[model samples]
Target: MRLRELLDATELGLLLLVGHDTDDTDDNDGIPPGTPLDRTISAVATNDLSDPGRFLTGGELVLTGLAWWQGDGDAESFVRVLHRAGVTALAAGEVEHGLVPHDLVRACRRHGLPLIAVRPETSFAAITEHVLRRLHRRDPGSLAGLAALVERHRRLLTDRAAPDSVLELLRHTLGFDVRVLSATGRQVAGARPPLRAKTAAALAARYLAARRAGESAPHHVTVGGRPYSLVPVPAPAPVRVPVPGPGPLPHPHPHPHPAELGDWLLVVEADTSLWATPDRELLDRTVELVADARAAREQANTARNDLADRSLALLHSDVPAEEIPLRLRSTAQAVVSGVGYWPRLQFVVAAGEWHAARPVPAAALRVLLEEALLQEDGPVPVSSEDIAATVDGDRAVLLVLVPGPSEAHPDPALDHAALERRLSAALARWLGPADSVSIGVSSPVPEPGNARRALEQAHNALRIAHAAPGQVTVRGPEDLTSHILSLLPLIPAEARRAFATRLLGPLRDHDARHRTDLLTTLETFLDCDASWTACAARLHLHVNSLRQRIARIEHLTQRDLSRLETRLDFLAALKSG
Candidate 1:
């Protein structure tokens, strides 16, 4: 209800004072007469303390007995506290005192808080009851609107309508743009125009920072000079654990802890300063509906995720080759819609730096993989029909469908470089600075029959990626040379160390004792294609000095560099080291 309506009530009419009684026009003691008074009263709370700001929320109409008021200075402090707490108006009861004090009126005027003087006969209870009644009663015209919204939400929950459709309905009903975003800044659903990925990431970062600081929700932030309010869509409450009875101990079930870092946010593209009570209530209801939709989507995806996990497991297991294609077809069909056969499938393995105390990086990586595959903003839109599954600790596997020739666009060859660039950019945008991600993409396999081999190739390629200097490495057909070297990662750590030590141990010891450069000279000579002059020039040494160093290397290692087999063995030993 409006402040003007409250003032004009029959029982409260004479009690309402808009300004100071004194003839000081500049010192209007309360809210201006012609100013808008359409603010809604959320609740009425009575306080007798000198400071009641802690108990007050914005849009509240505070009732006071003024029992703590000792002098004029107290009035100023009390009114200022209420003003800062966003109390919409003040109602002072004169039951303790004969009338409302002039000091309180002057204080309210200075703070621009509307003041309603409670009459001696009219009770505070009556005013509170009236406000509560009005809050519960909906407008007759809005009843049908509410019904339509409920029906739309029901449809959304039942899968008859999509999540974007609900966002569109809200836009039509409320005339506001809204979007649902994951904690990592990936847009889940909404009515477009869509937010840029970079902007969304920045906003998500701000929301996360505020949450970490223990700030309450409905955070207001301005992006691109436009105001927006972010309200967290809280996670569903955890299931209550049953108390154990006087029986044998039951087997403990391991349920993954709910992710504390990633939360969904409802972003409203409007200034919160203009939001009325009805607007806020509507937004709250919308958040609930969005949360329900997200839950439903996740429930549906669980089955597909299970299928992906099973398929990957089967590929790694000793499954019959003939049956592999059949099983894979079923899994592929569940994730990629309208696909009878997956002719070419590429496997991606991603691993990230993680700590035991922090949330699993693989969980976050899975979301990033999904977002990367579903991204439509890039020059080449990544298809949404991809499956990403967390396989083990700090690692996830993604199955990407390689598009083939279509009538509209005949050239179906995938741009490997562009895809890698896009994936790297997405990783940089989402992952925190303390974390790092490395990904390896395998060459496309012809069919599901080759999936087992493809998975191994991808696994080996991921090892190479970790060994390589860059954050991302793609293992295509031409990378077979490194594939042989990549097998070293699969060896046991102790065995690899022993092999390196045995081959180069003597050379290292001799060099340490004599201050010689035999090992370096040998490696440089081999790298220079056994050319004496080139190796000498590269090492900034004379030909004779290089020859002497090589002679000492040969004498120590007891190997002739002239033999091709010996050269290969030395190269292998160097690689192991």
Candidate 2:
């Protein structure tokens, strides 16, 4: 098929972003607009890899979502590789940027490669299918007829099946075992020999990584010696996970940029390439139904999130003193209604930033927080909307269950430190090049009346975290207290190192200069509570040798170790270092 013919198809909505604009003008250095792109399009391929050189050959039109794109240098390198690979033309998806990047267009033009711009309304799958059908000489009119048939089949399955059955149309009538999975690896629906949680999450990760890397779906893999195909349930327009509110939810983007962690995958226990043509089309239609299911699920989450958000707002509002308790209970009661008796809520405030110059949608912070929670707690107690999270400006606010302290569990039900670590890791998995996040947590609020104060504490902790220099920062109420060294998470690495050096600099320098073990001696000495005999026993040194090392430390640092305050200072410095 000719490039012009492909561009002319209304279904594809393809335009020449560069390479002699096709607007029938004599603007391309006196050449006609459509004259240059009259060459035949041999085939179509989608790739988002920064170096797709090994995948491409000559005379093919390559499609890209530009997810791998980071800077002008990236565009130049991609175009250079494509030029060497001898691809006929390039089509860039507007999914990420909402428009073809000028840098890419410049690079393509510089390399004398033709560039096509895909409209935001169109997906890479649509373009690939359209071009392939055109190349195969198939009738486009059959699409509507096929849709009608799929609808008839879908309705029959839905009518006969239970709600929450994913791909029941395929699982029941067709005898094709299929399952749907979320980003957290939760099996939304499936048959026997269920997908293990870890495996499902790994599969989801692979799919998401490929998509972000600009790879097309139907990602194939094998497990237990059986082949399976993972198809992304393409994100529906106006993703349902919107900003929660007392009023109607606000629809931000018309696409699914913010819903990566919420994306669902359709898994079939057979290679998609081996499927018959008719079955493939049917599977495609079934995937649409799954997307609708996902949307509905998100809609429900949005409602509960709205309720929680409203409650939080009400708790913080300057309403009549007598009404504050009632207002807080009125809204939060629904969310905590099903929790165990003596239920308590803890507040977590989070914020994120894209490492690149691009702006991350503030609302995505809510989804990121929710997904992070899912990774940590799983589905049992932390199901959808169970932990209410909402976006307030650039930050996300979440209310998480504070496992009630009981006789059986004397300690707090939650481990704040472990939660912080796990949550940081989980949040990182869902992001792209964006590597950093800051989270602040407040102590559990025993009663609804304390919700507003808890939020304030979380905000204060978040401020401290934001000022800290770290890739991932997590701070809680405990960090706001007297042991200043424990607040290291709220200190820049450079400053922390400098502080350690200032206090223990003499010992570290002396140890290094003389090649002695004074630093270790001091640490062990402090660790042993300044007991000379115990410190000597632990270090396998005689008491005299241990005393000499301590003497050297005190002499070098000009501090009296005999004083308890001096001992504490040295201990704190040693720990900081």
* Candidate topping lDDT: 2
lDDT of each: 0.63, 0.64
Q: Please, what are the lDDT tens digits per residue for candidate 2 over residues 467-555?
A: 77765687876654434566566878877778688988887788788999988898886655454555787899997888788888888
The digit string of per-residue lDDT tens for model 1 on 1-577 reads: 7666666668654365643343233333333344535555555566666876644545667777788887767798898888777777788988778888889888877777778889788776567656645655645454454456556565657763456666654543444567888666778788565798677867776776566445677889887887888888754332111222234322232223223233678887766545556657767777778777767755656666676687878776787776887888887777666777754657777765522223334555565565555555433345544454545555778776565535875433345565456555534433344434566666555557557655665666666665665544444423433555677789887887787788788899998999988888888976654655557878999977987887788888888775544664676678888
Where does candidate 1 have its weakest 10-residue lDDT segment? Answer: 236-245
Q: Cα lDDT for residue 135, model 2?
A: 53
Cα lDDT for residue 450, model 2?
Answer: 51
Per-candidate TM-scores read 0.49, 0.50
Which whole-number lDDT from 0 to 100 does residue 110 have in model 2? 71
CA lDDT for candidate 2: 0.64
Against the correct fold, how does model 1 do in TM-score? 0.49
Error of 2 at 170 (Å): 2.1
Clashes of each: 1, 0
